[model samples]
Target chain A: MSVSVQREDFDVGLEYARFVAGRTDVGGVALFVGQVRAESGQVAAMTLEHYPGMTERQIDAIAAEARARWALDACRVIHRYGRLVPGDRIVLVMTAASHRQAALESCHFLIDWLKTKAPFWKYEESETGARWVEAKETDDQAAQRWRR
Target chain B: MKILYFAWLKTKTGLGEEDVPQLPAGVTNVGQLIDWLAGRGGGFAEAFANRGLVRAAVNQDYAQPDTPIRAGDEIAFFPPVTGGVG
Candidate 1:
């Protein structure tokens, strides 16, 4: 039921604990955390830029859609912008439901949609220079299956 | 109308935003607008050379090629969403 877009890092353990704290109706919680990758030491850092107004709107809508489609008691989505290095957390999606099925599916759905739907673009700084990360066909295909 | 660019499009245009009070002749939709800009030559032309690589939104909502355009609205052009951690 909450979506946060920030330039700061987040703690996975802290977030997970806060998300399900005192929630008696929740039987299971599914979590997905995305962190910056080293990519064989080729990438030094990543800068994420987003449409200031549209990024939050799109993320909130994505979270809402997941809640509407799945039987979930609560959900949390957090995405970080600005510059980040390897090992830094980039995103988190958690879903809590009375059963594991809804929790797992909704968590997966949120992660997929956040990647394709959110208006954030990544710029990778490497040894040679910096370049915008290319969109992947596989990512599109992953999101496409949710439509069916 | 306000036109905003993002990512590589922003870099190619050498601009983040441009204000055009009126659409050029025959520019009545998103597709036509892109064509008009692409025909401008130089940076604009290069940015839009590959039609399939460009994506857009009208008034902050996802827009299609045939989406109607009118004065006083905002339009943004960018590449596909970078699908990764975020």
Candidate 2:
């Protein structure tokens, strides 16, 4: 399990290579990358804020939970904080397993859980003004599906 | 106790963090602490007016309204998380 919260961007290919390096047991790898989007084409930039210690710890816990639920050989979560524009990478989730189902399911679980459970916030700058992004009810519902 | 605010709450409260040597006797739990903070009036009141919007963490961990708190604890208040996709 690996989890990182940084202000700097990451290279997805490099990260994936490092995750799978010399891991012969892993047969399947599932990866997801989240990027900043101009939902209405009005967003100029976005500022991501997070609680320092809490952000990393929460993500680690989420990754651990995903591991517990699936037969994952390895899991990686990298989330970026600070200012970013549309198309900038914001987060990444990668999971490796002996089978595709485990890898894919774990990757999905990590992303869904991180959306609602992590301690990060976003502020968007647009034409009208800057405003804090509100938590979407759809995200809550997305996370709720994982609860057993 | 150290009280911290983040995101919009920090903007609304006009403060990022504060050191409170001690918490009042009634501020035993997260909920009571929020009530006391709201009583402070001014920006605090406005930031805490809507309980539905506020989220709390005790010592960097997500906390519920009834979570126990103490003088040495580090408490944080902020809006719900809006993290990016996977």
lDDT of 1 by residue, B1-86 (tens): 99999999999999999999998899999999999999989999999999899999998888899999998889999999884583
Clashing pairs in 1: none
Give one digit per residue, the lDDT tens place, for model 2 in A1-148: 9998999999999999999998999999999999998877999999999999999889988988998899999999999999999999999999999999999998988899999989999998999999999999999998999999
Model 1 C-alpha RMSD vs. true structure (Å) is 1.4
What TM-score would each prediction reach against the true structure? 0.95, 0.98
Interface RMSD of each: 1.6, 1.3
lDDT of candidate model 2 versus the reference: 0.93
DockQ, candidate no. 2: 0.80
